[model samples]
Target chain A: MFFDEFKSWQKELTHYSFEQVSQGDVERALGHERLDFMDFLALLSPAAKLYLEPMAQKAHRLTLQNFGKSILLFTPLYLANFCSNQCVYCSYNIKNKILRRKLSLAEVEVEGKAIAEKGLQHLLLLTGESRQASSPEYIADCTRILRPYFASLGIEVYPLETQEYRELYAAGIDTLTIYQEVYDEDIYASVHLAGPKRIHRYRLEAPERACEAGFSGVTIGALLGLGEWRKEAFFTGLHASYLQKTYPDVEIVVSAPRMRPHAGSYKPQYPITDAELVQILLAYRLFMPRGGITLSTRESAPMRDALLPLGITKLSAGSLTSVGGYAESTETGSAQFEVSDERSVEEVVAMLRSKGYQPVFCDWVNLRDRRGA
Target chain B: MQQVNCELLNDPFEIGGQKLRSRLFTGTGKFSSHELVPQIIEASGTQVVTMALRRLDWRNPQENILNYIPKGITLLPNTSGARTAEEAIRIARLAKAAGCGNWIKIEVIQDQRYLLPDNPETLIAAEQLVKEGFVVLPYMSPDLGTARRLESVGAAAVMPLGAPIGSNRGLQTRELIRILIEEISLPIIVDAGIGRPSEAAEALEMGAAAVLVNTAIATADQPLEMAHAFRLAVEAGRSAYLAGLGARRDQAEASSPLTGFLREE
Candidate 1:
C-alpha cells in the first residue's frame, strides 16, 4: 500500500536538517513554473520564510489560474457528539465528562432545513468516532434525508471499508473527509488510544478506498500541533500527491487545521503559529497548483480573510460543531472545537465579494435521481 | 467584365439539432468577468458556448451561470472531471436536469500531464449518452480510429485536440487531425491548443467544420477584441478553403509571364 511509500518519504524528509533548506532552494522553487516534492520541502523550510512575499504572489496567481476567483463555500453540520475513543485532544473523547447527544432523523431534517435557509447548497456532515452511534447505516440514512436539500454532501466520520464507502456513495454522499491527525504513527497511537481510530493504517488508506468507491472528492488533513509541523506537512503533501496520481479524476483537498480549544484540557504539544501555518499552506499551493486547499472556521476570521488570496480554494462558514446546534437554539451537546469565525453565511459571502472572490454554494448536481426524474 | 463576389462561404452546419450560423464556438472559463462573456460571445458571432457544472453558491442559489448567457445561444455543458464513462454519464444527466440542454461535451481525461482525453472512456460515454437522448460531442486526442469509433457511437460531432489543452501550442497534431477530417463522416471541430486567431484560421482552412476557442480569447488582454479577430479569421479561412487554395509546387511557378519579360530577354 501507499503507507510504505509514505513512510519512505517521511524517512527521507528526516535526513534533511532545517538549515539545509537554503535561500537558493527557495529561489529555485519559486522560479519553477511547476513544482515537485523537493520544491515543496524547500518551501516548507525556515529558509523560505524570507521569500514569503514572492511565494504568496505566485500562489495567488496559480490559484486564480487553476480555480478562478471563486471560493467553494460549505458549512459543517455536526450530527452527533457520541464517542468511543479517548483521544487526548478532542472534546468529544469518551474520557471527558462532557454531555453527548445524537440527533434523530427528524432532528437531522430540521437541521438540514435550517442550513438550507442559510442559502447553502453544500454541507459537511460530521460526527465523533463512534461506530455504535454513527454507524455506516446511520450515516447513509442521514445522507438520504439530507440529499434533497443540498447539492453536495460530505462526511467527516470514522474511516470505513471500501464496500462501506460504496454504500455511502450510493446513498447520495459525494465527498469523504478523513484526517490522519498526525502522520507519525507513535504520536497517532499515543493520542487515539483504545479505539478503532487508533489504527493508523486504516485511516491512512481511507481516502483511497473512498476514491475507489467512486467518490467525486476526498479530503485529507493533519492536526498541525501533534508533532513536528514541517514533518507533518511533508507527509500530508506526500499523501495528497500519491492520491492525486492514483485517482486522477478525484478532487483531492488538503487541509492543515491547527488544534483548537476543546472541552478537554489537552493542549498542543508543539503548537503551530499563524506565520508557520501560512508558510505551510503556501508550500502546498506551490507543490500542487491544481489541487484544492481548504480553510475552516477553526482559524480566526481575520486570518481566514487574509489567507483567502494566498491559496485557499474552499472555506467553511457559519459552522457549528455540536449536535442539533443548527436546528435549535439550545446547545444540547459539547462542541468538538470552538468556532473562531462567528460570522453568518451572508457576512462571509459579503466579505468574499469585498475581496473580489465569488462565494460558490452549489458546485455539484446530484444525478442519482435520474431514474425518478 | 462582370462583377464577382464570394458566395461559397454561406454553408451552414448542424450539431445536436442546433443549426449554427457561425463556425466558431466559445467557452466560458478563464474570463475576467462573467458579465463580459456574453459580450465576447456576441462579438465572436459564436452560436454555441460551453461551461462546466459545479456546486452553486449557498448565499445566492439563483445566481446561476445560465443567467449570463443570452437566449438563443446553445449551451454545451462539458463533463470535464469525469475519468470514467459512468461518471460522465451521471454528469450529463445532471447537466440536462439543470436545464443546460441535451448537448454534452464528453471530456473523460485521466492523464494529468497532458490532460489528454481518454479515448476508450469517451467512446463508452458517447455511446451511452447518445442512447440516452443527448447530443454528445466527444473530445479526444487527434486519433482517426477513435474519431471513427465516436462517430459509430452516434456522436453528434468529434472534437479532436490540435495540441494539449491550454498549452497554446497550435496544431501539433495537424497531420493526425487531417487524417480524422478525411476519414470521419461527422463534423470535425478542432478543439483546444489553439492559441491565436491564425491557428484557428489554419484549422478551418484545413476543412475543419469549426473551431472551439477558450483560453486564446479569455486570457487575452482584450477578450472582446480577440474574439473579433477570431471571428474574422474563421470567416477568412472558410472563404479561402471554399475558393480552392492553389496546390503547392516544388519549383517556382511565377504569376507573371517569364518568357515575355524584357529583363529576361
Candidate 2:
C-alpha cells in the first residue's frame, strides 16, 4: 500500500514546478520559498552538483548559526567481537582468522569508567551478530551498568525485534545506530554470505523496529565503498526521508562510514572521494538541515575537521575498535579496524574549542528541581 | 548622568502564567558534559531550563535530572523523545510523578530530519493534558492556524520553530511566525531553529514574546556569554518592536532635504 501510494505521489509530483531551492534560501530560510517534494528532488539533482560548494557554505553557516561553533563528541566501545555472520568485507567475519573476544560484565564496567574518566559522556556500544554470545539480555545488562556513567547510550550491534528494542530503550538506550552496509539488497546478501545479517529486509527494518520500540533516536547509514557511491548516497537519503515521514517523533541521525582498510580481499568497489563525501553531506543538510550527520573516526582528522562545520553534528572521538580498550587489559589485543583520528578526547575537545566551537558537556535539567513551588 | 544598570538586564519576563527571570530555555542534547550544565545555566542568568525525559532518570528521584539543577531555577520538562500521543502522555505522567506535572513543553516531532513538531500529536497531547489540568506549552511549527487551535484547546502558549530545531538557521520561518503573532492572542514563543543572538533579536523584533534556544547558546565556546548575548538581543528586539519600526518602502525616501541642499550649496 505504501509503495503504491508513493508511486502515485511521485507521479503527481512530476506535474508540479520543481524549481531549484537557492542555497541562501535553504540555509537562512529567507527569500527562497518552501520546496515541495519534487523541488527537493531538483535541489538534489546532478544539476545541483555544481551548486554543492555554495550549498556547503550555506550548510556551514546554518550549522554554526543553529548549533553555534560547537560539536558533540563521543567514542565507541566494542564490547564483544564474536560474530555469527560471515560478512566478506568485515574484519570480524566468522571465518576470519582474527581473534574474537567479548567483554565480561566487569570488563565492560572497567572500559566504561575509563571512557568517563577520559571526559566522554556519550558511548556507542558495538558487537558482532551472535545471539548466543551477546544476547538481548547481555546488551541490556551492559546498558544498565553504563546508564549512570554516560548521558547518552547508543547501540550499533545486531538488529533485534521490536520488543527487544523496547526493552533496550526501557533500559535507557538513548540512540540505536544500525548501518545497512549497502542499500543494494543483492550486494547486501552477497556480502553477508552467512549468518543472520544475510537477511537484508531484517536489517533494513531494524531502524524502524527501534523506533517502533520507542527509542529516542535511530541512526541510519550505508557503507559507501560497497556499491555505487552515488546510488547508495541517494538511497540513504531516501531511507532517511522514509523514516522521517513514517516516524516523526524519533530523532533521525544519518552517518556515512566509508569502507576503510580491512583484512578481507574485498576491496572497495567504489571509493567515495572526500569532496564527494562533502557533497553527500551538503545534500543531506540542504535536504534535511536539522538531521544529525555523524562522521566516524574512519576518515582522516583533517577531513573530519573540515566536514564538522559543513553539516556534521554528532561525532565519535578517541574511539577504540577493540573490546576492553578502556580497561587496557585486552586478552585479545588486536582491533577490528584501524582508526584514522587517534586523538584523545581532550585533544578533540581542544581542537573543537580552537575552531571556536563550544563543547557542551551536559544540558538535561528536570523541571521539578527548578521550581520549588 | 542617568545611572545605567545592566543588572536590570536580569529582570524577569512573564509569559502566560509562568514568570521567568531568565529567558533562556536550554536543550538537553548536543553538549559535551552533564557535569558542566549547572555552572553554564548559572552563568547564563537562566531561571527556566528545559530537559528531555529520555535523557533523564525519572524512576529514581536522586538520579532524576531535576536533582542536578541549581536551586531557584524553574525546570520546564519537555516531552522531547515522545513520537506519538500515547508516548507523550506516558512521558508526561512520568514527569508529573517525577515532580513537574503542572508545566510541560509538549514537543511531538514526527520528522527526525527537521525535528518539526507533529501538529496532530501536539493537538492530541495538548487536549488530553489540558483536561487533566496540566499546563501545556506546545512546541509547534510556525503555523498560526495550529497555534489558534492549540490556544482554543487551552494551551498555555504556542512555541513555533524559527527553523528546524538545532539547525541554527534563524528565522527561516519568519513570515509564518509573524502571521502566528498577528493571528494568536496567546504569547508566541519562537522556539528552536534560532542559531544566534541576531536570530533571537530578529524574532523579538518581529514581536515574539520570548525565544527558546539551546544549541545556539549551549554549543557556543562560552555558553554563559552566548546566553548574555541572547538576553541582550531579545531585549533589543523587543524594545525595537515596542519603539515601533517605520514602514518599509520599495524605493528610498531621503531622511534629509534631498532636492535642494546640495544644489543650493
Candidate 3:
C-alpha cells in the first residue's frame, strides 16, 4: 500500500530542507536519461526555478512522444451537495448556509441526456462525503442510469470498501477520482472538523481500494493550498508513483487542484503561485510519462490554455459543478466551488483545435471493467 | 533448388489477403509535428501506418488523425495501452465500430522498464480478433513455440521485437527471429528496435518478410531523409535475401590466392 511509502517519505522529508537542494542537483535531474523519482524531487525543488524553462521543454517533448497531441475532456456532474464533514475550505461544508440538493433518479437521466447531447462520451459523477445523503446503492443506481448515455463512467464520491468499489465497477463505473483534501495530518484534521473524511489514511488509500477492486483508471491528487505546497506536491507524487508502479496496467492520472473561492471565506495558508503549479505539472510529466496529467476547470481559461503544452493530457470542459446543473430543473444544488473557465463544450473543443490538440471524449472502451451494462 | 530471379523478387508481398507494395511499415508516433507525417510516409513508401487508438477523437472528425495520413495507406490501429486480452478485444471492436479498418496490432505490454509484450495476453487477443474476422498482427518476443502457435491461430503475421520498443538497440533477437522465419508458416515481420537503416537491411537480409521502422525514422534529425534511406535499405535487403546471402565459414576463403603470394607457401 501507499501508506507505508507515504509515511516513510513524510518522516524522511521532515528534516530535509528545500533550501539545501542546490542548482547542481536540479541540473543533474534535468539531464537524466530516464525518468526516476530522485530526478522528480530535484525538479520540484526550489533551486529548479531557474531550470523551469528547460523542465517545461523536456516535459513537453516527453508528453508528446508518449501521449500524442490529444487532450481528453470530461465534465463533472455534481450529484448532491449534502455533506456530513465540515471541510472548512469547501463550499459543501455543513456549517455553511448553502442550498444543498440531491438529484432524483429522473433528474439524473435528464442530466445524463443533456451532457450526452453535447457529444461527450465520458462522464465523471461527483458527490459530497455523506453516506446518509448518498449511499453506495444510490451511487450505483446513478452509474447504471448514466451508463447507457456515456461510454464510460468515473466517480469522485466518498471512499468506500473494495467490495463497494467492485460493485460500482460492475455497475459501469470504471474509473475512480479521489483527492485527499490535504496530506499533512495535523492540517488535515484541522480542516476536516467532523465525519469520515477526517480519516486521512482511509482517504489516501481510497485509490488503492479502487485499484484492488479492478478499476481500470484512478486519478489521485491533493488540494494544493491546504498545507506546505512543496511537501504536499511531493507526497502526492509519491502517492501517485506508488499506485502507478504497483498497478502498471491501470491508468494513473495526477491532478493539482488549487483553492478556488467557495461559499465560505477560507483563506489559504500556503498559497502556491501559478508558476509553481506549472513546475508541479511539469515534474509530474517527467516522472511518469505514461501516467496522465489533468488540468481542472478551477483555473482560468487563459491559464489552462497556456499550460497545455507543458504536459497536460486530460482537461475538464464545460463543467457544471452543481447538482442538476445541466438539466432545466427548478431545484439547483449549490456549487462546490466557483467555475473559473466558463467556456461551453463547443468553445473548449474549438480552443483545443486551434491549439493543435484533438479533444478526445472517450479514451478507454472499459469493456473488461463493465459487465452487464 | 531453383535460382531466384528478378520476376520472383518483384512478386507481390501478400499478408492476410492484402497485397502490400512497400515492405517498410511506418508509424505516426514520436514525430515532432503532424505536418511531417505525410512527408515521412511519402519518403518511407510505406503502405501500412500504425497509430494508437487513444489518439483518435471520433466526435471531432475535422481534427481526426486520418486527415494527416494520406489516402491509400492502410492504418494499423494498435492497442498500445491495453494490458489484457479483453482490453485489446475492446479496442479492436471500437476501431471496427468507428469504421477504421479491421487491421489491428495487438501490443500487450506489462513491464514499464522494458515495455516487454506479454505473449500470453497477445495470443488470447489474437485468437479472439481473428475469430471476429479482423486481421491481427501481434507483437511478441521471438519464441519458436509462440510463433508456431500464432500461426496455428490464423494470425496474419507475427511481429517480433528486435529489442525493446524504441530502445534504438537493433536486432538483439536475431537468432530467435531467424528460427521463427525458418519454422513458422506466417510472415515474419520484424517490428521495433531496428534503429538504423543498416539494422533494417540486416533484418530483411536474414529473411524477414518486412521491417516496421518507426522511432528510427521518426526521431531522426532528418526524418524524411532517414525514411528514404530505410526504404532503399529495406528494398536492397529484400532483394539481397531473394538473391540469397552467401554461407558463412570460420576459415578465410581467399580470393585471388593472396595467401600464396604473400606467404610463399
lDDT of 3 by residue, B1-265 (tens): 8675767567568887999878999988999888999999999999999988775455775455678998889999999999898999998898888877899999998888899999999999999999999999999999877777788889999999999999999999989998788657688999999999999999988888898989999889899999999999998888886654542322332233211211221
Instruction: Please give, for residues A90-154, the per-residue lDDT of candidate 2 as tens digits.
Output: 88888888877888888888888988888778788988788988999999899888877888788
Writing each residue's lDDT as its tens digit, candidate 2 over B129-236 gives 889888888998877567767988999888998888788898888888987885576778889889999988888778777888889977889776877788778778
True-structure lDDT of candidate 2: 0.75
Give per-residue CA lDDT, model 1, range A86-175, as digits (tens).
899999889888888888888898889999999999899999889999898999899888988889899999999999999989998999
DockQ, all candidates in order: 0.01, 0.02, 0.01
TM-score, candidate number 3: 0.61
As a whole number from 0 to 100, the lDDT of residue B183 in candidate 2 is: 54
Please provide the root mean square deviation of candidate 1 (C-alpha atoms, Å): 22.1
Q: How good is model 2 by TM-score?
A: 0.57
Of the pair 1 and 2, which is ahead by lDDT? Answer: 1
lDDT of 1: 0.87
lDDT, residue A9, candidate 3: 82
Q: What does candidate 3's lDDT look like per residue over A1-373, in tens digits?
A: 8888888887888788777888977876776544456667877889988767667777777888999899999999888989999999999998999998988988998998999999888899999888999999999999888887888899999999999999999898999999987999999999999988889889899999999999999998889999988888888888887887667668899999999999998898999888788888888888777789989999999888888888898999999888777877536889998899999999999999998999999887766434345
Show model 2 residue runs off by greater than 4 Å: A1-45, A363-373, B1-265
Interface RMSD of 2: 17.5
lDDT of every predicted structure (CA atoms):
0.87, 0.75, 0.86
- Clash totals for all candidate models: 13, 16, 0
- Per-candidate TM-score, chain A: 0.97, 0.88, 0.98
